[model samples]
Target: MDKEQQIAPSAGQKGEEQHAIDVGTGEHGDGGGGIAGDAAEASENERLALVEEPGKKKSTRVAALDAFRGLTIVLMILVDDAGGAYERMDHSPWNGCTLADFVMPFFLFIVGIAIAFALKRVPKLGATMKKITIRTLKMLFWGLLLQGGYSHAPDDLSYGVDMKKIRWCGILQRIALVYFVVALIEAFTTKVRPTTVRSGPYAIFHAYRWQWLGGFIAFVIYMVTTFSLYVPDWSYVYHIDGDVNDGKQFTIQCGVRGHLDPACNAVGHVDRMVWGINHLYMQPVWIRSKDCTFSSPRTGPLRTDAPSWCLGPFEPEGLLSSISSILSGTIGIHYGHVLIHFKTHKERLKHWLLMGFSLLVLGILLHFTNAIPINKQLYSFSYVCFTAGAAGVVLSAFYILIDVWGFRTPFLFLEWIGMNAMLVFVLAAQAIFPAFVNGWYYDSPGNTLVSWIQKHVFINVWHSQRLGTLLYVIFGEIVFWGVVSGILHKLGIYWKL
Candidate 1:
């Protein structure tokens, strides 16, 4: 397949038909001569004709979607590099939304949208499934290699790699799983019949019955499993008392009624049992410090160093919560269908707004009614709804401003970043950039280059150490990667799995 075809499937469409306006030369195609020139001109004419056709859906690429994905990637890098500097920039303690929390959902939502556009172009299911499986495995492997497994000690910064204790799941792992699940659902449910029947405002619903039903089923399953499942209550156990050599002790318990506790919850319990505490995230918010400790009045001491909510260990991106992550991706798939299937720009925008509003209202109702609290750790139904709603609104705004109003000039940089998203992300997170920052250092102070720069430049300039450190890391990564992406884009070097 060609570069456009490869990138199109992974994110938004960027095929020949969907070419963005040439901001540089104010012309389409590479402006070559001979057979290549003739073919490019013919293709451009066909695209223009398609756009001018009344009532026919536009086949051009959605620039706004690419920009949106680019924006998500930028935010992901920023928040990930923030290193928990500000409370609002990190994932919420237990419940509610944070700037950081919104990034993953937004990325997943965009993935769903991309899936719709990508799969529809391919006629064969086998080809689509193969692509999905390969991509999923690639992401899972990288996530494990990069963010998973062993971590360095905070104090001594000692490096250790323990296969037995390596973390099993992480951000890329979740994305892979979620994408694969949603793609499977789409592969089976996507209609073979062309979307010819337009039912006014219900056009999107009528067009995607199978996708809608699949999403509904996934959502229902998520809610039922999260709220109705019975979990063990370990509130009574203060702390385990046993000799290290003997390993014999009587465990105590408070016998709490429900499973919302961190340790006893279904998600955490399953993770601990399957992966072990050593494999789970060692420092979750629920178990960070003494003040964050959980105490059961019915069990032992009033306060214990042990975390109240979590008894053993838990992972936010664990197996159970992945159900909801799939649901989130399913929602994105629906949005993707809207983008591809809908005929008119206005019709698409209207449906997007309606979907956004409906989800926001439903999420609020679910949270307020206490049916399911908006918890990111749990990937609660309410959290999915709210975040998806927010994502829709944000995407719609981008669509309007960038694609609809032809305000593409200002966001060309983002387009550059979007074009080489996975390349930049992997480089920033796993390979070259991070290694360079950590390994390349000055000798005098014996600090990493990043730390030295932050201390000397950003910290010295800003005076407030915390704010300067945070700003330097976040913006420094963005600018560095932005420049790299821009260079790659200019060279027409786009990477894909």
Candidate 2:
């Protein structure tokens, strides 16, 4: 489609500010479009006024970025609420990639891109650092508050709070850590040049050469540390007995040499040593399920039973692996630099595609070499390369279709969700919608609205119980949050952290 050349101007705003590839041209093809556009513009103007110093022109937003973020957020909600109904939608067991594995890396990649645009607008590096620190703390607080601090039996909800067993790290905590590290890198590494002089390819290279080098250095360090680090050998640790000595006699070995087992990996060992087993993820697959048994009516009893390797006491979003996550953010920062440096649409698209393809090829090659497996839990070099490449390509497609060719309306729903991403994420994860859904449940059968809807509506219509439950959770949450985000967008009520 020669879509690269079709750079449609964002109507009503000065044509000088390009919308980027994923952002739609701010032109309205119908009456609803005008109203929506006006509302979005008003919200953005207000946001800029709050963050920006007085008298400076409001920063132009790239709709594509918001759209991209919105899409990622939607998918996040879907997979999260899927509740392991679809095995493919769940994270890969150990050493391979899956559809569910890309979300966090994609979100981190976007954070790097946003940092590039954000820091450029601020005049003082001190102020930028302060803001970054505050946001990082906020993310950490929310992550722990919402996802950590408590563990309870699935069948019982009346247990007392267990202080000794509370988890500390979570999804948002990882994001917070990654964002803090990446922002610091940007603040120190990126050169703040005058806005008048166009940032050419050479200029960008000169400015960010160190960051590129730093990213490479980080990647090498991660590979060496992950593969060479000595970890406790727990290959023989069968079950979690009350006595710690049962699992304490194992020796340590290098992770690269067949030590990637759940209990033996360096990442899990560090976490357990630091946080204790009770403070880590409790229901790791290594813990045998209550219902699982060796015998059945049709089959004879088995000789021995043990915890599955999949359930080893390891946190995918653990501390040690997050170092490689920084590498993913570094890739995003590189993309952000390209977006800011390149003057024309063609230049940006060309560089983005080149970068995307190069990453894809490199990731695949690394995977094939078997030196670094594409493991999401470990945040392996190959995993970051592949996901970052996929993210870049997806952003490019959005740029071409939405910003370049002017296909905007179909994605307006996503834009609304993007506008209040963090706010909606917290709301969806924490109180608002979940409380509402819980309100419908009752002790007796046929009294709860959720069960009735699943049984009659989704199950009856789809003719599959699994599909019905999946749709009910995924679509139900998406639609609920979509409406909430839409109302907030219309009313200009964005809650930024």
- Leading candidate by lDDT: 1
Quantify all predictions' global Cα lDDT against the true fold.
0.64, 0.63
Worst 10 residues of 1 by lDDT: 24-33
- Report the lDDT tens digits of candidate 2 across residue range 360-474: 8888998888866788877887899899999999998987777766687888778888777777777764434454454555885335665576678787889987798788776
Candidate 1 lDDT by residue in tens digits, 1-497 = 23222223323333332332221111232110111123354356435533322554444556777787778878877766664565456676676677778888887897777666445544576766766687788788878876674443122233556786688988889988887877677676655535454667775666677766766776777666655666554322223356231332223253433355454566666576677656777556554323353331111232444434434446988877877778788788778776655545676788898999888888889988987778788888888999999899988998888867778888876777776777777776444555545655567324777676778888888998768868786667777777777787777566654
Clashing pairs in 2: 21-399, 22-64, 22-399, 23-64, 284-311, 285-311, 286-311
RMSD of each: 8.0, 7.6
The residue-level lDDT of candidate 2 at 363 comes to: 89
lDDT of 2: 0.63
List candidate 2 stretches off by more than 4 Å: 1-60, 151-161, 190-203, 234-258, 284-310, 429-432, 444-447
Clashes within 3 Å, all models in order: 8, 7
